[model samples]
Target: TKSQKIRAELLFKQFEDIKHVYYYSLELGKIFSTNYDKDVARAKLALWYNKIEEYGYDTFTTVANSIENHYERILNFFVNRSTNAAAEAFNAKIKAFRASFRGVVDMRFFLFRLAKVYA
Candidate 1:
């Protein structure tokens, strides 16, 4: 696995454009891992956004725009470092259940089954 990872990194190095994008992504991940004060975190996020913009990758640009649109709400994470993981997981489970059954034909029955299984 270590060798495989090295090979992957080498492959990534072959593409100059991709290397910049990957490095920016890694920096973003580093920012998220540390517990900085709100102002510091906001500053770091702004810097990250600027770097992403400089790279001019279409995908990263879309992500940066979304972050800018929700700038204030995104900064709220620094206040308590909380997330909506539980709610997201529940939504995923409901989606999987619906997919497994192809569709929910009866609303009442579906609600009952969901209560029994997930509630």
Candidate 2:
């Protein structure tokens, strides 16, 4: 672990760009992890985006563009701090059920069985 840490430190020292990206990503993660109000979150994200734009890293530029594109959807997280986990879990269950049978033969019957089991 110490060796790994030393290696990481050496790499970061050698590559300033990598260090900037890594720290910036961590700062971005911290913004989402905090329980800020929607307005505050918007302001923080805007500030972060501006900083990233000024830095002008290609990776962060692409990420900033995506964040701009999905700004409203991203902000929806602050409304209730919810995610699509339940829907995703249900989808995973369905996929597992289908896999257990190797494949679906009768589409109608498969739906009936899925409803019976899941409902």
Q: Clash totals for all models, in order?
A: 0, 0
1-119 in candidate 1: lDDT tens per residue? 99988987897879877778878888888887899888999999999998888878998999899999999988888889987788899999999998989998998999999999975
Off by over 4 Å in 2: 1-6, 95-107
Instruction: Score candidate 2 by lDDT.
Output: 0.96
Q: Model 2: per-residue lDDT, tens digit, 1-119?
A: 99988998999999999889999999899999999999999999999999999999999999999999999999989888888889999999999999999999999999999999999
Q: Each model's C-alpha lDDT?
A: 0.89, 0.96
Q: If scored against the real structure, what TM-score would every candidate get? A: 0.75, 0.78
Best by TM-score: 2
Cα error, candidate 1, residue 35 (Å): 0.5
